[model samples]
Target: MQRIDSVNVRPDVNGAGKPGFHDNADLSGQDATYLTPTWLNTVQEEICNLIEKNGYTLNVASRQQLYDIIATNDSVTALAEAMENRLVQLQAVLATKSALEQGISYVMSELGQHKTASNPHPQYLLASTFGVHIPMTAAIGRTEIKDENRVLGWNGQSSDWTANTGEITWGGSLSGSVEFTPYRAYGQFLLSGYISTATFFDVNVRVFNAEGIETSLIKVTEYGGSYASYGMNKVFEIPKGGKAVIEYRVDAGYSKRAQMTFSVYVDDRVKVFTPVGLTSVVDATDFTESTQNDVKSDYSSFPAFEWFYGDTNGQYFELSAISNMSDPVNKIPHYHRDKFTQLEKDLYIAVQAGKQTIESPSDYAVIDTQILRARTDAEGNVVVAVPLSMRSITTANNETLVYTFVYYLNEPDVTGALPVGLDGEHKIYVRL
Candidate 1:
């Protein structure tokens, strides 16, 4: 008796019944047990269960509906993710927009540029070659143009006043146009100049725009006859920017004329605030678990920080950073430093850093509604404080920590004389 392979050599029925009757009986049916037909059936059920667990129903009878919903929901989720990514970008744009609306500039520049980040105005310089230093005391009470007063004139187009007017013509100053630009909102200029009486005669100043329109006389008084050693100083404001002509008219006014000079100092409307470094340490794994309040112990222990202005533009949250890192101005924090105490330095550091963070939520944070009221202390300095709350974050090891933060009022960018219309009628004089 010999053993035969059951897979390829099946029992030969013909060999038993009839001699030499060979037949190749099919063995394909035996291979049918390799895998269960229902193996893939679980895949559909798994997909259906996934949808159902997510508050969706997958009815195989309505395959179209299931696919449609899956695609629709996928598209919606994709859109949501895209929107979240755009949130920060949109906030930056909105902040810039806010600054612009308040006549603020977002572009940074060097000092003395007289240009705001968002606004740049006309830049003026005096030609050094002109010998126009006037003696002191040439300007006195109620002085007008008279003989023997050496005038200091500017044509705006050139540094050579003598060449253009052929010896300082009274009305020969070349007129330049004054155009309105965005930086005009930051500040204005009114200038006045005259010859000193100590080494000179009399001096009077007048301003004219590019349109040949001369503004009203701003400095009409004379400084001569009494104060002979003091040079004249005048500060004024010009509302517009363009070619400005300063007329150096003079008066003999019972004094000798001296060499004259003029200069301008501008006050900018917007400024930059530098950021103090992060006082709190955030765990890389879970941001929500990172407590910020614990890092800053007190105002004295914390690094100084500053904030410029920002716009909301109907947003739920906004993030701002301090870019200026030099010469941080001392400011009264919304919360007093002597008030709180913690055993760990990290705890105080976290609190100070957290206080500066800005956020917008569906509802106001409990810490945002408080106000920073200021009162003059015995030292004549303003002290500000606000109401605040504490929050705790627990780690996986069951250790819990707390952070403190304060609520305060937000100041807008465009702030001025608070009563709105009170300063509207105020006027300052500009000479050139």
Candidate 2:
């Protein structure tokens, strides 16, 4: 785009009485004397020509750019300063973008017939209208209030649901089986067995689905004749009307008496769980109504997910989309400092990709676990020019924290930024 124009050779006139003006008498015969004034001038012109040809020649339109680079342009117009200015501009743009994105962090990703399963709970989610529970909703701290909470299941009383087999005589590697069915949604199951006159017999245990399919199997090395029974927890998700069958068999042909039992129970926990699709119903379109709504109140079909049961209902719409410690993807973005989205006023989920979607409260899990999972999304064929996501969060509440400080009583009264006073007492520090 730019180039320098070349100038031909040229030199100033020579001095009047310069040396070698003539073949001097003393140095007359030197190799090429006096190269006279004309000759000297000619050679000087040739050197000047070479210099002109060697130099860069440009026909630049903006010669002022060259002037600024070659001459210090007040230090402010240099390339480094220009770069710094551009960086400042870029940072300003990025800061604005981050503020805006975070402002709407818990908001729905998209609109249209969207559906989510928080706030009102899936049981109370209206069928015709899409509903979701999102950050800062009314249900933010009420996850433990549902009837399905494990703490609610135990009243310091014996479990209302447990099945067992009494001692029975059997021989020739005989097996015993026990089955238990639930009338309502329940979780927290355990397995244990006893044997009479075991005499160190090898045993095999198994679990089966309703279709009599063996879903899991395990072997035990020995069972003693002692009265102590072996116990194990976290059986599996067992839905209502669905029966779980467990069977135990001994390897020896010795005649022995044996029994097995399984129970649904829970222990004391710092956290609680809730049932889905089961929220308080109100008549007004706004869920804050005083009267009960005539629509979507039947919770008979809502699946109650127990805490420690892993994730949400598989055959259902799941996840609070509510901001919790592990699943903080949904929370009140801000109170006075933040703004809430209108998935209908800080409500439920908006599946990023699909709109016409259906989620039922997960009935049961196919895995053995006790911890409720974080808000999870199904993996899919999602590819984008710029991939992004968000997860809400706060401090975990599983336990409490305490701090301590120590000081010696005999040190000198040290002053001004010392670790301890001269009296040996340590100084307390408050961080800014």
Candidate 3:
């Protein structure tokens, strides 16, 4: 008759039928915290078989072994070693211009920021702040489609130039807005004012992001570095693409006069290359698929995509700091006097935006590495067709699909005058 959900019940009768029995020992009976004592005692053999069938022996030794592994892996000493290695890498990268700086305020400023989802390094700025400007130049071309260059002057308060010592003290700060590319932001300062005997200048540079919500970075470098080492990459890398406002101040510095050549050049290390006809050939989903060979078809279709610096058919990847340029007698000379590094690496690809969808040629994508080689045309320019892909978030209205081709050279390091940092960074953006 009556069904009970739960009952405060217990068994009192022994197996011999008398109540309150078994006086010798109750150790022979099996018991479990989960199940009733009657059920456990009846199916003790089945319980052992179930654990054994799972191929794991459930015992105190097994639990102790698992505990030992977790303890060894999550040890404080192992975590400390990993942290120490990361600190060393950061220190090496910052050692260039941060030598005069003491506190790591620059590194700590990025503590609150979160990295990207898939590619933790950086991503391309889509529908960015640039007109229909072409990314390619005439013949030898490697220019960014979107770039910002602002020449800043030391407009802060400063003491009068000391005629006796020829050194003047500078104080206060001056700010300037610069347009940043996706991955790189460069700063070039003409420190001719800082050339004094036994005179050192501690300069603090603070960079803010486009939104100016938080501090992007702050680099403190003595104005005593060499001529070619004035770029912000020597201090730290700024991986933002938009309006970047930077404030420069002299914490402690002497100057002949406030140099007006403080400039920030926004040109990414990643290059944008628009293919000839991609949307007509490949689908947007097929662009990101692993089983595609756009590189092989690039020579006939994507002639604008160039990677290596070869002089086979009279075209070469040329980088010049101060080649074939007029002398700047009024400014201090370092790297490129024009503020921006001029690179001419490939032929110009005329921009052809579609009517239905927009094209973002500056968007960079990762290469599949299987199709990361250059195919030579019939006595034409060398075409390195790198089939690269990025995420395509479908929208309600129109969408822009940007395909990039990035190649990594498997060449060995050369110990010579030519500078080398080509660790799989031959990037090109092609419109699909």
Candidate 4:
């Protein structure tokens, strides 16, 4: 510590045309340290804090006296010690009050233990996931395209397609009118109920933007041979409160022999797609031997079935291409693109209802919550910060929960790119 020869604290005493200047001719007889502006600020702050703690007013006389004493190195050190003690006391009180008011009890309970019944399928519940089965089309000119993305394959025996005459005629007798419904306006009116018969039916599903012009055509395949079933899904994003159209060519089908059913189960109940937690009951059995060892395998064993239903399990869930269209918070992907945190990974594993976490290379977790809060560190590895609510466990024999994650094709930066032409689909798989 250095002793001060004297003290001079004033602003622009002489007309030097500059601020914060000091002259030191009279201070030669005194023992004092010439404190720099930064050091002086530190000393002043400490003194103010001490006075505040003791309930004293910062008067001019007191401030000057303290400034004079702190000119010596010994007093400066003592002042620092006094301020630290008072600051610690103030911090302790503030922390305690903050904890009480913020409802820390609930946060503690959620963090301490794991939750059971994480995933259970409910009865009468609308299908958790939304999807459209796109049958082969004549415009694309290829019926034998590989089903690379969908979990299920097209099991139809024949891919043959024939065009229908524009005129709705059954041997020159038009008994009914053909109604056209656009897919863009689907939310306003949706069709529900199972179509009992698998017959060759023609329905022109149209989509439009704000201009009301037809944007795309999703043609439903004519299901003919062996009582087969074929469908199409048209997914797009529109402005808020904007509309689309679905024109069903109800008259073009072979309806004279049998009335083919075109059931459209439409409602707002169809929620946005979610990624199931890896430890969820529906995802419990999705893990494989390779996944347990953290080894990357060609075939990742994802959650294909729930344990409660035993070995008779298969994937079954509807898909809606309009995930980001809903504008719901969690319906879209999270901002973070990093690896999972310890707490997040633990919560994911703990929330699995009936599934057990297995150590295998094929095993992975699915995120099923509609919303996600994810973050990343300096490293760019992807991880989930928020835990998602998952599907429920099922007791039905061979019934399985389907894992759903969005796949971005071609443009990773774009949220609603179609999965048709990209390098397959960017699908994230998990089981619960």
Best by TM-score: 2
Compute the lDDT for candidate 2: 0.29
| Candidate 2 ranges beyond 4 A from true positions | 1-164, 169-174, 184-188, 200-214, 218-243, 250-264, 267-432
Model 2, 236-269: lDDT tens per residue?
4443223454444432111224444333333322
Worst 10 residues of 3 by lDDT: 331-340
**Residue clash pairs of candidate 3:** 140-344, 141-345, 141-346, 273-429
Better of 2 and 4 by lDDT: 4
Predicted candidate 4 versus true structure: per-residue lDDT over 286-375, tens digit per residue = 112222111111111222221111122543322232222112122222111223232211111111112213334333333232322221
Give model 4 RMSD, 1 decimal: 33.6
Give all candidates' CA lDDT scores.
Answer: 0.28, 0.29, 0.28, 0.29
- Model 1 — which ten-residue stretch has the worst lDDT? 163-172
Q: Write candidate 1's Cα lDDT for 1-432 as tens digits.
A: 132333433354436522221234355444322222354456556666556644455665775655665667785797789898799666766777674544334222333343433544233211111212111122223233222221222212221111011121111112111221112121243233334333123334444342334664555234423214344555433323322333332222111222333333223211111212111111112111212211111223222222211123522221122221122222212322222221221111112211212223222112222112222222222212222222122234322121223212222222222222211211111111
Q: Which is better, 2 or 3, measured by TM-score?
A: 2
What TM-score goes with each of the models? 0.19, 0.20, 0.18, 0.18
Residue 128, candidate 1: alpha-carbon lDDT: 16
TM match of model 3 to true structure: 0.18
List the lowest-lDDT window of 10 residues for candidate 4. 277-286
RMSD of 3: 29.6
